[model samples]
Target: MTVLLTVLAGLGLGLSLIVAIGAQNAFVLRQGLRGEHVGLVVAVCAATDVTLIFAGTAGVGVVLERAPVVVDVVRWAGAAFLAGYAVLAARRALHPGALRAGTEGARVPAARVLTAVLALSWLNPHVYLDTVLLLGSVAGSHGGDRWWFALGAALGSITWFTLLGVGARWLRPFFARPAAWRLLDAGVAVVMATLAVLLVLRPV
Candidate 1:
């Protein structure tokens, strides 16, 4: 029962941190909506989260916490990437005719999608802060049960990404319209831009 509670705590905290609107989640949603390489994208995200969580649990967090420069570098790179993606999204939103619903759009290369998702996953400093530092700190509080907490966090990440990628298909009908694509892109643009700015201004 004690182990279960620790796991639950980790799971809940993991979900709370990851479920928010962010560059990674936004990109995942867009990929899911396009029905293109959703599995690959989801796998990359979940795997990255699991890897980071475990790394943190393994005491990597202590090393990273002491080196603020590493976080700053990631922050700047993430900001640049987000800003560029936001521009692309804004352009897409402006040209609704170029947009297509479901699998109707021009096929993007899987390699390109892979690169984008990886950039989003690895470049974001917030991931290091939340998944590494915060989660690691909390897991340490559990003492010998820290691994259980890490496992639960990993499970939360796997569950969330699987549901997000697989469940996005249900919204295909709604996204069938050009207007919906525009709205979605517009939202993505705004979100990406906002996050980019925040990443630039916010200290970790």
Candidate 2:
């Protein structure tokens, strides 16, 4: 019973940390909506989160806390990437493309998708701060149960990403129109631009 409760606590915290309107989530949603390589995108995000959570439970957060410069480098790189992504989204919004459901449109190479997702997953410093530092520290508080906490966190991440990627197909009807795509792209642009600015001002 105690172990189950600890796992649940970790799950809740993991979900709380990720269920936000950030660059990573935005990119995932976009890929989900497009129905292009959703599996790969979700896999990368979930795997990265799980790996970092476990690393934190293993006391990597201590190393990170002692190395502020690493976080700064990621912050700057992430900001630049987000800024560039914002520009691309803005351009897409200006000239909205047709919504491609499943295998309906020109396929984006899987390799390209892989690269984009990898960048989005690794470049963001918040991933380190949240999964590595916050989650790690929290897991450590559980001592012997820390592994259970990490497991719960990993499960939370996997469940969320899987649901997000798979469930987005249900909204295909709504995204069928070019106008809807335009609106989504515009929102993505705004979100990415705002996040980029925030990272610059308060790099975490």
Candidate 3:
């Protein structure tokens, strides 16, 4: 029961952190809506999350906690990255050309999508904090069942990405309209801006 409880806690916390509106989730949703390279995108993201989670479990989390400077640096970098994405999203929301540029977005190359997936996953420092550091520390608090906690976190990532990627097809009709893209980009901008501000102002 103790092991089960630890895993459940990790899963819950992992979903809470990951499911929040952010750049990664926004990218996933876009790829899903496009229906191009969706499987590859989902696989890469889930794999990256699993890698970071285990790295955290193995001791990186402790190292991060000990080095307050490192966390501060990451916090600022993540804030900047998120804020930049917000600007791009806002631009897309306001520009008709930008929204219509990739109307047949299905033709986008797999390599291009993969490159973006990697950039969004690795370039964002938030992943390191949430997946490696935060999850690691919490898992360690579970004592001997830390591995189970990590596993649960991995599962949460897999499940969330799979659902987000596969289930996005259902909204295809809505996204078929230019107005939908405008609304989506606007929402993405707000979410990104909020997260960036929170990152900068939050106590490390």
Candidate 4:
């Protein structure tokens, strides 16, 4: 059916957008390895993304698209956040021993985890441009059953984050090694810094 094809297309597109080693995914993996509230973090990330995708599909993204100034503000803010996060990640990478000797069994508060996930998910302009404008545009092409397209996109978010969390958990043994953790922290730093530079250099 045409509807089925559209939904599949949306799913594919959504997955492609999210299946990257970016700040969000790196943070989720780090928290998961730390034995933190992995489920809550993944759920919050997925749920927040789904909400934004729905808003975009409902034509809210069009209104946002019309306001260039608002988009500019979000862009600059996201850039700044990414830069700050990059600094923290770089610091961690440079001093992995400090984190290694700390309370590995320590639990982060649910509220803090939720807040971090929400900020990572919602504060990025790429989130809006990808989920809202881009995905919404694709979904809008589905005519009468656009909601199905949105559902498929939402499903993509849920599937990806769930898999990431579970997969990271399975890799806990590998991450337990000090060298491995150091490499991961360094990778996170590089990814975040790259994203931050890209965001800053992006054409407004």
Candidate 5:
């Protein structure tokens, strides 16, 4: 019973950490609405979480604690990437591309979609701080139950991304119009830019 509670506790904590608006989540929503490359994006997010959770559980978080420079590198890189994506989103807003649903109109190349998600996953310092260091510390403190905690956290990632990626289709009607796409892009642009500025000013 104690173990079950611990796992549930980990699950709740993991969901809390992840259920925020961010670059990765925003991109997932966009792809989900567009009905393109949603599966790959979800898989990338979940897999990245799995790797980080396991690494954190195995005590790699301690190594990260000692190496502040690595965090800084990711910080700057993430900011740059976020800024770049923001620019792209702003451009899309200005142009207002058609939001075709379910394999229609024109398709964004699969490689491009995958690359964007990968960059969003790896380059974000917050991901490392939250998933690797914070979660790792929490799991480690759980001692013997650390693996179960890690598993719960990993499940949180899988569940959230899967639902987010799939559930975004519910917004398909709103996104079907060019005006709606423009508004969405404009919002994404703002979000990415704001996050980039925040990253520069205060990393992690």
Candidate 6:
């Protein structure tokens, strides 16, 4: 019963953090709508979150909490990755046919999609704070049953991403036009760039 309660608490916290509209979610939705590797994208996001949550529950998060230099390194790397992705997104927007052509020709390479998803999920400071620090701290409060809390948090991530990807895919027909794709890509580019700037400016 204690574990169940802890799981519920973790679920609530994880959902609260993830449900917000952010660069990560925006990118996922855009990719899903584009009929990209939606399942792979969702799986990567969920798996990354679960892994971090597990680490946090296992007390690795506490070690990271005390390592200022490590945190700084992660922050900078994440910012650089996001910035690079933003540039790619902008270029895609400008060219217009690149993404569509890629989608048409070769199914957008599973490895490339997985790498992008990993970068988006693992490289973000917000993800660390939300899944590793914040959720981990909350789970740690459960004493020996912290794993239950981590399980709950993992469930939240899985549920949310699955829903987002599946739901967005259902809207594919509505957003099938070239102009719509261009608008979505442009929006993704702006959000990703803004997130990169914010991450860079954040105090280490």
Of the candidates shown, which would achieve the greatest TM-score relative to the real structure? 1
**Cα-based lDDT at residue 103, candidate 5:** 28
The lDDT leader among the candidates is 1
User: For candidate 4, lDDT tens digit of each residue in 9-53?
Assistant: 778888999998788998888887786788898888898789988
**Any runs in candidate 5 off by more than 4 Å, and if so which?**
97-105
RMSD of 3: 2.4
* Tens digit of per-residue lDDT, candidate 1, span 51-149: 999999999999997888998999999999999999988888887555542236578999999999999999999898888888998999899999999
lDDT of 2 at 10: 92
Q: What total of clashing residue pairs does each candidate reach? A: 0, 0, 0, 0, 0, 0
Model 1 CA deviation exceeding 4 Å by range = 100-103
Candidate 4 RMSD computed on C-alpha atoms after optimal superposition onto the true structure: 1.7
User: Candidate 2: lDDT over CA atoms?
Assistant: 0.88
lDDT of 6 by residue, 101-177 (tens): 63345667778888888888877878888888888888888888888888988999999999998789787776767
Model 1 CA RMSD to the hidden true structure, in angstroms: 1.5
Against the hidden reference, what TM-scores do the models get? 0.96, 0.95, 0.85, 0.92, 0.94, 0.89
**Residues 1-204 of candidate 5: C-alpha lDDT, one tens digit per residue:** 878878887788899999999999999988898788899999999999889988988989889889999989989998999999999888877763422332246688899899999999999988988888889999999999998898888989999999999999998987767788888888999999999999999866
Candidate number with the higher TM-score (5 or 6):
5
Q: What lDDT would each prediction earn against the true structure?
A: 0.89, 0.88, 0.85, 0.81, 0.88, 0.81
Q: With candidate 6 superimposed using the best TM-score fit, by how many Å does residue 148's alpha carbon deviate from the native?
A: 2.0
- How far in Å is the alpha carbon of 145 misplaced in model 3? 1.7
Task: Name the better of 1 and 2 by TM-score.
Answer: 1
* Model 1 TM: 0.96
> What are the clashing pairs of model 6?
none
Candidate no. 4 TM-score: 0.92
